[model samples]
Target: MGFAGAMVVAMAVDALLGWPSKLFARIGHPVTWLGGLIAAIDAGWNRESDPPALRRAAGIAGALLVIALAVALGWLLQSLLPPSWIGIVLAGILAWPLVALRSLYDHVAAVANPLLGGDITAARAAVSRIVGRDPAALDEAGIARAAIESLAENASDGIVAPVFWGALFGLPGIFGYKAINTLDSMIGHRNERHEAFGWAAARIDDVANFVPARLTGFLFVLLARKRSEALSCMTRDARRHRSPNAGWPEAAMAGALGVRLSGPRIYHGSITDEPWLNGGARDPLAADIGEGLTVYRRAMLLLAGLLAILACA
Candidate 1:
């Protein structure tokens, strides 16, 4: 019953009016709530004193608990709605805060605007909010690359993936995905303490993002001005980047803009010697970030259009 249409509403609302500050001040975001839960579970279950095998098991149990709680809340909310057109609208409104469509665009634009003004200091500050790398080390070219890469990668995780699931499974889908994603972000790292314990969270995140990531890449390819190059680069270079999911969209963006991305970079004082996507291409300029935003908007439109078609069907 208009599942696709509900997603369309969620997209439209979020794009027009992002999560308002007043509302956020009053009630913290769903992710923050989930994050609190994850933190508690991590402190309690992910013990440094525990053996690695038992820590792994505890992580699994903790992950399951978080997922179950989110899924259950979503199910309960969905059950409260009457099954009608009104319910569809309500469903979309509830899912609105989950998608970060406008937030991603605005964040990348924040970098572009300052860089365009030739304020390297301001640009560096803007980009640092979004990327994990050391901003102080970045020149204009580095800032541009970081911002565009963030735009492309988060376009999948922040927008398309949630929309894909929400359209298919309503509240349960979006909520469950956010919970998984948040857990991964918080605990899924190869640090000494979390390497074994966070294994389950990392693996689950990978599996969840697999299809949405490719779909996001395809969307970029379909609408890119340099369509053929985008396709070729995505196919040839996606695997070259570090992440299985992030590389698809990031490579496609690199090809679409005719700019190289994902070469070596410093993260927290250490160099991550990542392979480049479209390595032969020139590095991105500040203006390329603006161009990347245009492409991003187009790809999102194409996604919304497809969902609209399905809704009419």
Candidate 2:
């Protein structure tokens, strides 16, 4: 079986079983393991008083070490299996944890379910798990907006990007990409402790995600009911957001749902006046989050279909 075939099987398994809770309780998720390594590096090396250049160098070294380890682990797994169909199945099993389609949907649903039930506090608490923003201060609209934004961004990072790399370079590629993403999540920020130190990790993540992010936006446009509006928002507003890669799916999502996103918001008690995508659109409601999930589901299905076709070809 080819890499694309393995990807299809892995995605199906993820959609159906979603990292079984029993298994996870016994042996945590891949990201959790990766996080431990990243945290250790940060604690050991990311000193607040270190010179900016030295800190940056240390961060880069740590990121490189993590990437090498991930790749080596992937290679070791693949090497253990005979080069046959069984190897492909084992590869799919190993690759399954790296993709987050089911987990992402579940997390978003956790927020939407509470909001739909009219429990604002529960909604805020659910959204806090997926976002860094201050959740206690959020209203219903704020909670809904945060959930939708996180869904869009993570759909790209947690789903499409992994599939893209897995299809191209098999297990090693996907694991390496996950390492980059994990490093960024742990240390990539503009805060005083991370600004200089995390520069390399942030930039590396941006580069790794560049193509996959755009592909996710294209999938969103295809699935969106308002295709023209989604495309227009992607073209006009994607570059306006802070990150080079995040805005693509976010803009498409904003236009698809006809709800504005990425406006002024509080993060860790600081308010950032970010540019709004689809600025004139309506503020998101609980129903809008449901609509966004519909779009995300369709887009994921479309991606699976495409991968299957390529595998067949």
Candidate 3:
């Protein structure tokens, strides 16, 4: 068994078992641990009084340090483990937490379930856990759109990208990608606190996500009922999104579900007049969220099948 074999097992394990709550309570999460490290770096070096250039340099150093640490750990695991069934199983277990298919589905379902029950308040609260925007301000359609958008974007960031790297560079590759992603999440904001300090992490994350985002879009196109619309969204509207990589999957999802997304969202107290993807499409409903989950499930299955074929080949 090799990288592809290990990834297939890991993905299956994640989809079936996810992370156990008992285990999580005992040990927390790998991403959470990485976030702690990032926070420590910010506390130590990302000072408000520091010059922008110096802050940026410190951020880069911090990101590099984390990446090196993650890669070193991954390499050590691979080198120490013998090439046998035990090694493959150990590798899969280590990689399982990095892939987030089941978690994503569950979180999105939490929002959809409440909306389906006609509980707007619970729906709003559920959506708040996933998005950065003001959930309190969202109407039913807005909440549905936010959940679908998060599902689409995270399908790339949380699932496809990790598998892509794992297939190409084994455990080290996946761990390194996760480290970069965690750094970006912790410090990669456009606000006063992180704008300069997070520049490197943000750029690195963008580059890391570029190819995987497109792949996610393509997966959406395949799973979408309206294939042409999905393709059009990926080629046309994806470019209009604020983040270079996030737009691809969001556009594909919007087109796939035939719903408008990403226009005039409120963050904190300010309104961001963002461009809409699939602007002419219908407003999303709770039913559309269910539909999006169906498409997401199909896409994950397709990805798994593709990886299985690759592993055999």
The per-candidate count of clashes, in order, stands at 0, 0, 0
Candidate-wise lDDT, in order? 0.93, 0.92, 0.92
lDDT of 3 at 150: 98
RMSD of each: 0.8, 1.1, 1.0
lDDT, residue 172, model 3: 97
User: Could you tell me the TM-score of candidate 3?
Assistant: 0.98
lDDT of 3 at 136: 88
Candidate 1 C-alpha lDDT tens digits along 257-282:
99999999999999989999999999
Model 1 scores what on Cα lDDT?
0.93
- Which pairs of residues collide in model 3? none
Looking at model 1, residue 40 earns an lDDT score of 94
Number of the predicted model whose lDDT against the real structure is largest:
1
In order of TM-score, best first, we have 1, 3, 2
Predicted candidate 3 versus true structure: per-residue lDDT over 108-139, tens digit per residue? 99999999999999999999999999998999
TM-score of each: 0.98, 0.97, 0.98
Q: Residues 1-313, candidate 2, lDDT per residue (tens digit)?
A: 4788778878998999898899999999899999999999999999988899999999889889999999998877777876777877788888999999899999999999999999998999999999989999999889999999999999999999999999998898899999999999989988888998788899999999999999999999999999999999999999998999999999999999989999999987899999999999989999999999999999999999999899888
How displaced is residue 18 in candidate 2, in Å?
1.0
